[model samples]
Target: MASDPLFERLWNGSAPMEEWTAAVSDGAITAVADGIITVHTTYFCGSVTAIRTMEGLVLIDTAKPDTAQRTLEVIRSWDDSPIHTVIFTHGHIDHTSGIAVIDAEADARGVPRPRIVAHRNVRRRMERYVASHGFNSIVQGQQFNKPGYVYPIGQRQPDEVYDETLSLTIGGERLELFHGRGETDDASFVWLPERRVLASGDFVIWVFPNAGNPRKVQRYAAEWAVALRHMEQLRPAILIPGHGPVVFGEARALQMLRDGAEALEHLVRETLALMNRGATLDAVLHAVKVPAEYLAKPYLLAKYDDPEFLVRNIYHFYAGWFDGDPAHLKPARTAEIATELARLAGGAEKLAERAAILSEQGASRLAVQLAELAGAAAPDAPRIQAIRASVLQKAIDGESSLMGKAFLSVYQRQAQERAG
Candidate 1:
């Protein structure tokens, strides 16, 4: 992990440096609220939340498959209480893959397996994951800058599925689960009314809510805002987010939730207005600017899903796949377009030379675009491949968002292979 310092930079963009250092220093299990302990992971994976109930432990979301053992150990250290229940905030791989670890632990202890609970749509999402396992693996590899990662396909089917809301009395403590469409259709937020604690799945991740993941399925931007607004009204005194640090006071929690919600609301409204005016998706993307105040908030950085992508998502939701450009509606093949551009630019060599010059001048995006054109025009050109790789590396270094860095790194690695 130390070899890739950019991961830390991108993940901890808005959070305090010392706080991040402290939280990640050995995966300490800290009490966010009374009887509620959280195991915050280092990267983008969801944090594991364990609530100490009278009967046993009630976990809200588990760590990724790779980090489950360590996270489980951290939870066990806090209390040896057998896990009585596990609630999946959503069916995202990182949050659900650890179920096997917990189930195994329960079996070894001679106790009944923990009852799993989630939104009804979780099974549908898991089925989709099963169907597109290979595609998901590839897309996540590009998204996480870890091409070698093997995403586990196995998941524990939820024992109990709820449609809208379900209040579960676990170990004599009440946990209110509300289904909300946010990052996923299977999203749920847990509210402990007695403790004034809320476990917001990916809905309240410190980063700008991931309502515009380019490769992922549909995200609920407007509905996500609505969910946040609802959570804000609940006024959780202690807010445990799916990722990043937990919020302490009700005021701070409301502020964070409201800010995130309003940001999405503003973006959605602005995008719809542009769409109503018959503006192109590209134009809408450029037109809808996130409010300066929201962008300036420490909890709402553009490190993950930026506002431009959110605008595009809104456009896609309302306007469909067509970007309103007649030429793009039935676009020519990329290679053919590149070949034409290369011909007009004199030759592939000239294009490669120009790309290299642009790369040297720090025009990384344009350099990469030109290099791609050159590579498409002449697939076997080593010079073009090298130029593309170099520019992509530069772009990766300059990128502040993890998504952008991942794409640039993957593209750069591919370019290097081609160059070789």
Candidate 2:
């Protein structure tokens, strides 16, 4: 019941953009390795890897909260074996929130609840989530364009947490989990030494590593590269990435890991080089670039994250938040500054007009900034609000990364409502 060829096409770099993005969230269960099945979940979420062991099944990732039931159904359709354990690749809500549903399902089946596994920091992250539920809900709403959506905070926590490595034998198959800091500080990647299969959490996603997610907390660009390169050394014959299609064959799998690592390593190295030379964050952001060679491979596409964001992330961990600009260190209020600029520029209408012209000329990067200033200067101006909404949509249309587009959509919707 799976078009396994889709995975093959992705590995070979022949899958068209249309077909590729569609399969990104397709819940189709495909047997990628001998006994391992990969079931992708919704967009912006990780994939569910169901590994059938001798005694029972070992599931790596339960997917986001909304996709939990569907992921469970697919796994059950493939194998009725009781889930012996559920290993979370990380504590990201998109990957860990489904634990509650999974645990309830086990209880309903009259089976022992599977042990939920993760890194020790995962528990810490959950604690932070509990303490900052309101903040997270607002962030998630802006991120997913769910204006009034509330983030589910009652999800179950991991029962088994490891600091470094955890080895488990389920159904006679030994699965090795190695901890690494990637998209999040608490991250784990599974390795099947016998099968040469690697379940790399978000470390080897088939897109630019999300080392620079703008909305999230601290991320490790250097550590993320180290993690991917470490997995490459294992020479995994099959790779089930955290968010994209599975990669079969040793060369294909290694290529994905290597390419992703190389890009992040380049960003980290370049950002550090500039920072060491006393360059500003803005300067380093524009100077560092992803070698064009990686673009040839579809797996390294910047669909989920941007290289510029990764550069900024490198600057974040190495250098302090100061952008090396005296003006930015103690900037005046944004609205006040916008109002002043509008006064100097003749009015908010002129700023909106320039922004519209810039957007039409494909200067979305500049246009969006101007539009924002216009909106701040004239928050109740219908004409300014309309122009700001259009400019925001233009930026969203031109954006190639999902994270950037999602945040832009949130603002655009608000602008539209004000304009109406």
Candidate 3:
């Protein structure tokens, strides 16, 4: 069960560092609203919302592949009613990988297969996932702190696909699905009119809106803001987010939608303004900032994503890969550049030494960069590997965002393994 004190701490933006540290552990399933059950987790991945209707139960997401069976057990414990529909909020593995369990369970019970629902672009997203399966496996492993995780490529094809809006009368209860491009191109949010319950997939995750994932594909920040604003007007009494605890009350839910939308809007608008004024992407990243008031909100914590990343995403959205810097437009290969820097700095050993000094001085950011250059210059140097490992671990320790920490630790672990 979700703890009341934990919710209270999250609600007040006072959750301690210890609580944030424990966010990776699996959470319990519990009811957030009448007839609405949600599984909240640290990050947005694997969280799901279940809505009970007169005809049957409607599942919002299927959770991750590892957690899918557990999620099904929890749902079965609550209601033995067959799942009438399974609506995927997006094509991300965490949201879609659990469908196999649902499929098998339905077969065991001799029930008809539930109608899988999703946006029209979901198929395309899955196709992309298949095409880049290996690449995604490597990158996502680092991003999610699962070093050897292989992203499951199989997805239960949606029987019902909609371009924009789809209305369904499930068991005589009207449910609306709206297509919104936020974290991913194929994202949707569910709206139950009579129940006044809104299931916002990734559009309104508890942490900073992931409009800017550095390693992922393009994220639509402007369109994401517009979608949030649209949902805000509906005045949902209970907001079940893709991640985080369920939000109750009209006012609180509205504020969440409005504020989350505004944060993205502010980033997009500010970045565009700077670009219009001929500022470079690097300049815009440092210049734009979310309002302090919004930053103070518990729901707006930058646990997964941060403002600078969003700024960079907006930059990439409007401008292409170039950051308006001639030097970066056609830069040398990273390894080559690192080799050159090492040569200029009196060899890789000097770079490694400098990085160790920097780490001791608490200059983790600079230390990691120097360590990377050293590692690139001398990939098999035991001394350089040790410095890189120590420096990167320091950088990881200093990072607050889970996304940043995960990526940083990837190199840290690699360096340690190499040294050993």
Candidate 4:
């Protein structure tokens, strides 16, 4: 273990909930089983897990940029062996960018660089990331509270790409690799049969499974559950999650994976059932729910992704973009609709007043809806914009998920600007 107090508490399974949160967001290195250590690089993306074999060292994820550099320094101080293999859990920049630093280190020492491995789709994802760099930059910036964050260009392509599964024996330690679609289509998880440790990439993040990201591409919710099930069958004694602190024991690891998988499965089942019954998107969004107990688990909190958002992704995958509403098929512009609605309500101020009343009643959803309409109708009205800002601030305060909170903050900033 890292020998830090927080890390010690986590290893003992005696840490409070808030401590778990801190352990992940901040960087640290901890060893689980012998020769297997996980470096929590950056919670915004994922962590890096390194397995030391008799032949050399193998890494699951390199982390990214500055954090990766810091982690690499710590790793070099402890392990001097050449990195023989670098396994990328996924194609995300955070998981792959550390290759640059690793390669640089190898160059400095005049040693062979590690072989980079990933699923074939990881290459395609890297290509897509390069092609859509601008778009990704904007969304990532908004999600992380960086207004103009630019997605790094030219991510490294994996040296080896597998289609289904691959197994390798490094110094008698058997490492099994499998491809399972989850947060990203190219996701892969590592299983060390000998050590009984599972390096579950983003498939098992500490928070809610990011089965659905409102602003991102497709995520496989049902398949994600299947992936977790596969991991549960392995019966790993230690779990190195994509972002969180290492799960120390087998029972705790299995329970956490099951909780995440079951939560995802329940969401998909409920959502698909509603869609099959010809329910509109809005109707299904409000109707579908994961059991309260699933959400109550410490590992399954909606800290990054919400269950309701996953329902939307299910609808998008099974049903197309159409929401089954006739009016939405060719609706008028939002501004046009808002103008007419405000006129009918007497004025934008009237709508804003009603929004304020609803906000005071703790009806944040309805309050924000009305406030947006009011703003659309009269963008220059400072008093109306102030009410809109208040409604948005309330929504921001109530959000549990980091993604939801960051997005709401963007809108709240704009509303505050207009208010002035």
- Which one is best on lDDT? 4
Task: Itemize residue pairs with steric clashes in candidate 2.
Answer: 54-171, 55-171
Which of 3 and 4 is ahead in lDDT? 4
lDDT of 1 by residue, 1-420 (tens): 012253245333543534674657577665776788889656467888998899899999888877788889888888999999999999987898888999999999999999999999999988898898888989988897777666677688899999999999977889999999978999999999998998899998877888888888888899999999999999898888888777777877898899999999999998898889999987887678998888877778888876777788888988789999898999999999999999999998788889888988988778889988888898888878887788778777877677877777887887899899
Per-residue lDDT of candidate 4, residues 111-199 (tens digit)? 98889989999989988988898999999999989987998868668888999999988766788999999999999999988778899
The TM-score values for the models, in the order shown, are 0.92, 0.93, 0.92, 0.94
User: Whole-model lDDT for model 4 versus the true structure?
Assistant: 0.86
Candidate 1 at 160: error in angstroms? 0.6
Candidate 1 Cα misplacement greater than 4 A, ranges: 1-22, 359-364
lDDT of 4 at 200: 94
Query: Would you list the C-alpha lDDT of every candidate in the order shown?
Result: 0.84, 0.85, 0.85, 0.86
Runs with alpha carbons beyond 4 Å of true place in candidate 3: 1-5, 16-29, 32-34, 39-45
User: Distance from true position, residue 52, model 2, in Å?
Assistant: 2.8
Tell me the alpha-carbon RMSD of every candidate. 4.2, 2.3, 2.7, 2.3
**Number of clashes in every candidate structure?**
0, 2, 0, 0
Ranking by TM-score: 4, 2, 1, 3
What would you estimate as the lDDT of candidate 3? 0.85
In model 2, the runs with Cα more than 4 Å from the true position are 1-4, 12-26, 41-43
